[model samples]
Target: MAATPSASRKRILTYITDDSNRKTTFKKRKKSLVKKARELSVLCGVTVCAVVCSPFREIETEVFPDEGGVREAYARFKGMTQVEQTRRKYSQETITEERYEKVKSKALKVSTGNQEKEMTEMMYQYLSGQLMSLPAMNLVHLNDLAVVTQRHLERITEKLAALGKEGDSVLMPPPPPRAPASMDMGGGMRNDEGNGMYVNTNNRPEGPAC
Candidate 1:
């Protein structure tokens, strides 16, 4: 028993000026808008601020999941405005080009520093082999590693088979872990072991032949 779709769906547009209906629509839309705003902020993990004013009410409504999120968003917006205002003021006042350049240079340095810091952290992790730790890898990341490994395995197998006849000393390497022949890209992993969508690299075939 499933619910059926509505026969008459409401079109989204400006509500007509019927006082009673408009009030009802405003309340409904306001609630929906606030819910959507909260959901968007949560899903994207970003600060979001939505201010709503109704003609019927004296107080304005602000929608934010966190108490400080609205303040932070407002401060960021104000900072941008102040920066643009300062830039415009400096341009109009015939400030020395060197001073303006210094301001721009400082901003660029700040941006570059942040990027360099992130890159340095990643490089340190990679060099130290800390990045190989898999507790933090999501399903999508794991799946991608699996696919890359499968392709590499195929290449190695083909090369080994081709060069096996070249010399008696040319040893064949152990075969790679068996993965599903085909997998649904949308799903994680699929195989006989019912391990879901995650490719299990630990399930290496027994006995090293190479």
Candidate 2:
């Protein structure tokens, strides 16, 4: 289930059009805003002040904590070190942009991982004789599989080139023999009739691998 977005994560924000409603909204938002600033100041031991210009002509400009507080905060800000100034000046837009980039990167990684899994599953299905032909798959899946296969071949080629003929023995050493389940112990070959996979039992098993 998708979680409902919080008030802070509002999808769209616009000014209230109705005069009465706008006035009411302004008052409520201003109160909450001032409350938050006060809480931040008290909790974090920070010097904070808010100055709100009133939309209603009757009401004068509003300053949270008061004019003295604003002046004091301004003086402290001016006296702050460059590092302190930098820490305080990182804007909402900067924070939002960073979060967006992180989310985008994570999403891309997940998408790539899922695509690889799907293509691998398709390849295994074809090899196991579950899928008879390429025509059985959709255009998109077929294209993705082809691309994945090409890349896989390219990677293998790169590895083989790097390793040269020296590591040819290491690349695909030999398949281990499976014990005879039903047939007699002739130390012969085992053919998987279902998938057309063959296993040679003449060679001894090597060190730890499948």
Give the winner by TM-score. 2
Candidate 1 local accuracy as lDDT? Answer: 0.66
Cα error, candidate 1, residue 155 (Å): 46
**For model 1, how does the per-residue alpha-carbon lDDT over 44-89 read when each residue is reduced to its tens digit?**
9876787777778743565565558778887876778666756645
Stretches of model 2 off by over 4 angstroms after superposition: 1-20, 132-210
Runs off by more than 4 Å, candidate 1:
1-12, 58-60, 65-68, 81-210
Minimal lDDT window, size 10, model 2: 177-186
Give one digit per residue, the lDDT tens place, for model 2 in 164-192: 75446767768866544444335666654
TM-score per candidate, chains pooled: 0.32, 0.52
Residue 131 lDDT in candidate 2? 80
Q: What is the number of residue pairs that collide in model 1?
A: 2
